[model samples]
Target: MNDTREDMANRVFLISGGTSGVGKAIATGLARLGAKVVIISRSADRGQAAVKEISEATGNSRVDWFAADLSLQSSIQEVANIYKRKYDQLHVLINASGAVYFKKELTAEGIDRMFAVNVLSHYLLTNRLLDILQESGPARVITVSGHPRFLKNPVINFDDIQMEYQYSAMRAISQSLFARTLFAFELANRLEGTGVTSNAFHPGRVKSNLGRNAPWYLRVATPLVNAFFKAECGIGVYLASAQEIEYANGMFFDEKKRIIAIHTQFEDGAGNRLWTLCEKLTSD
Candidate 1:
């Protein structure tokens, strides 16, 4: 992967949810390659700790962080503004922040917490930074998605997008995952001729604290499940740094780096619908 590192060095990568779990793993991997990795965190103390940990682990001091609550659109926009004000170039953006809520909840912005963090956050953050990505040219936007096998019959309930009527954690998480993938593909379609590309990938069953908000029993079992899964995010790192797929767009990749087809259902203009909905929801 020397070539990957060579390409990554001196480049800028901004990652959400980089303070821990899959985001942290990818951030560490990128930092080790000498890339300027900036992570977003909801807590400043946690963000600083993660930056220190990544820097110490990778021996790369360019790793830094910005604090932003992914559940809030205002916070995301503010962080994007901060990033643009502080940095001039952005080579890659990894939308790795995710959340799983057992009960239905809404943010101060009146958005479903899971939908806000998992889908809209990716949408707004990427859209906010699109201009910079285009200026940077040959850049990429990689979104984290669920395993394709688990999303066999992916369908988005546009009418109940917020899960207002009946809320099940499984249903909420699945819909968010599907919507995020759809957003990635739609983004690619919109960015067809632009120098920037958009794609999504499943980082495999890596150890993560996504279940931290679950019930106590589930929280207690998270470590055991995580112990049985791989921890390193090689696929995320590969997708972000590999030069071969620099122009790859609207693709879904597995942990093995193989491209998976977008579900045919998504081609029915669902992406555009989702995009429009996000536009309305996140609009000022």
Candidate 2:
């Protein structure tokens, strides 16, 4: 599973949230492999700084960045258009942008902040770029998921999807995780013969700014939690560049690259329901 510069040279990878956390780590890894890496960030200044840092750190000038607010469908569409116009090929698309909001809020589009970011954004962005992905045949769509243990009994309450009645930060976060994973699986099934594979993986407990919007206590505890769990980008890099799993789709892999069986709950039409819901939420 070793990727050489020669093997990765000129290969294109587009990563959402590439300015931080697992996204930045994977972007760096890909850049180091000699691939053309494009990352999406919400802030122009931060995106430029990240591009410079990753380029300098990896010594790969091919690293680049684009600014976009993933929580907004219009923003995602605009960025995707810009990306397609600038790049002719997209070898890999990594949906790694995520966040935790201590307070329940809605985006301008009237979607829950957490769900819009963690779930709908992935759906819209990926679908918007599907043509390019298929054109770049043998491409991959790698999504970021939480720990398998937390997802063992995944549930999506379509009735109260926005948690309009009773909203806890944890409930919102959990629902987003489940919905995104379902989207990944459902995407794989739909792209079965398109030569574009889709899979989800846990990036482990990576040291990240995921808790930046959380309560003071949780934000304060982030550093301590990160001290014990480092950002592990091996699986992300592997899934993006691995020759073995080039066609692996509808699968879930752990941080160690072990394929875990998808829970039966996900197979019972939930993926379809989630996909339909996303289609409605993100409809132009």
Candidate 3:
């Protein structure tokens, strides 16, 4: 399914956490297509190697990587500014990094690491790069969510987004889902008329390391789920090439490019609420 119509020739695709898993898959794929790919990762060594691997495989030397920990708000600001100064315009921003922690961890900024990495980092990165994205015009921000948006554990206890008060596996998963839906919604709302589409995807239970830190049951069962299904890391490109907000700005997806629209949580009210809360927390 080569999508040459996308015309990504001179475009730049910036993705976080591109050293491994689905991030690596998309980074490499984008590079092969002649789009200048910049992979932002945590480790300089790993980041450079990822860029090298992509360059070698694609025979496209336009790929590069830089290191930055996205969990901290300050780090995100610096990285965003760096990208703005470095690139004239960004055609695509894939905020694909995510985390699911068994126990609570805090960023240097004292925010919950799970929320900071999975939700807040993506939020701040997208907002900070909003100028570049809009300047590029017709840019796309494809965030990685999980399966069946409705089947998700969907409890949005705003009082417990961090799950610090009463932490549990279920609570963490549920809160993350709620936050993602709301993030997509609010981002799409804010990007209206800018031609910068902000959408999220359900990458399915791929053979990825998403549950590496989870309990034995989760860690053990994820492979089983992938084995019983088609686990193509390149399924990400299906998302990468899909009609950019041709239907709706903030739609969800299932495994096989199926659109999932459980709209209650992604509605305007919930989206606004989440946006306001995040604003208070970051207070930039």
Candidate 4:
């Protein structure tokens, strides 16, 4: 932790979805350690609020914000371009931006809203910033993933990648999470020996605004569930600052510690397919 803290000072971090929830916590923790934090958000008002809160809370005025609709590839590319123009290097890139839709819908881009926000945005943004991350050497990429028990096989439906044919609240959320996990692992594989490490984690059921899209009953139950089972921002602090897992790549964690994903398919050949699909989707 000491080493991580010492190394973090003066370094740059770009965190998507840092406006609230676990992402906000991580941004605040890193800023306290003296890192130059750049938070990307869809709304300027929310972004400014988060930047002010983080700066005041940590007493680190280096915190800044970028506004972009991550659900759109063009917006993500623009944000990346702005980041590159402002900062010469990025020491860490945290893909913490995610969302769940109570009902199936498509974005203005004609892509499923869930897939666009939860999976595609991270995919496009990470790839766009890969060069600077590699140039920064010893950089880290941490993705916030979810843990959902599924009743059916969690395979990518190439025929209808965005759940256009069939959709349910749970199924839509599950699909995006599965895609995110695969992208994290696939990213690790591609970044091997590049001094860039990629990993994903389940932030452990925090009482965050990520669930605002849930039904009325569940939204009402959020406080109770969090009271009994939610985890603190400490786990996020550990993952970002702990020295032991600095070199750890292609791994999935429950919280602070590394844990194996029960299904072997998570590490199987599915990643290649997903990667290929992502490449095709994001290609010009």
Global Cα lDDT for candidate 4: 0.81
lDDT of each: 0.91, 0.89, 0.76, 0.81
Model 2 spans with C-alpha error above 4 angstroms: 1-4
- Predicted model with the maximum lDDT: 1
The C-alpha stretches of model 3 lying farther than 4 A from their native spots are 1-6, 149-153, 215-235, 242-248, 265-268
Model 4 lDDT per residue over 34-97, tens place: 7889999889899999999888888888899999999888899999999999899998898888
Question: Per-residue lDDT for 1-284 in model 1, tens only?
Answer: 23236667779999999988899999989988889999999998999999999888888889889989989988998999999999999999999999998999999989999999999999999999998999998899999998888768788999999999999889898999999999999999999999999999999888899888888988999989989987679999999998899889899999999988865656488888999999999882
lDDT of 3 by residue, 118-210 (tens): 888888888888888888877788887776635344657677677778778666766776687668767887888888887777766555667
- What residue pairs clash in candidate 1, if any at all? none
Q: Which clashing pairs does model 3 show?
A: none
For candidate 2, what is the lDDT? Answer: 0.89
Off by over 4 Å in 4: 1-4, 148-153, 226-231, 261-263
lDDT of 3 at 211: 79
Residue pairs of candidate 2 with colliding backbone atoms? none
TM-score, structure 4 vs. true: 0.91
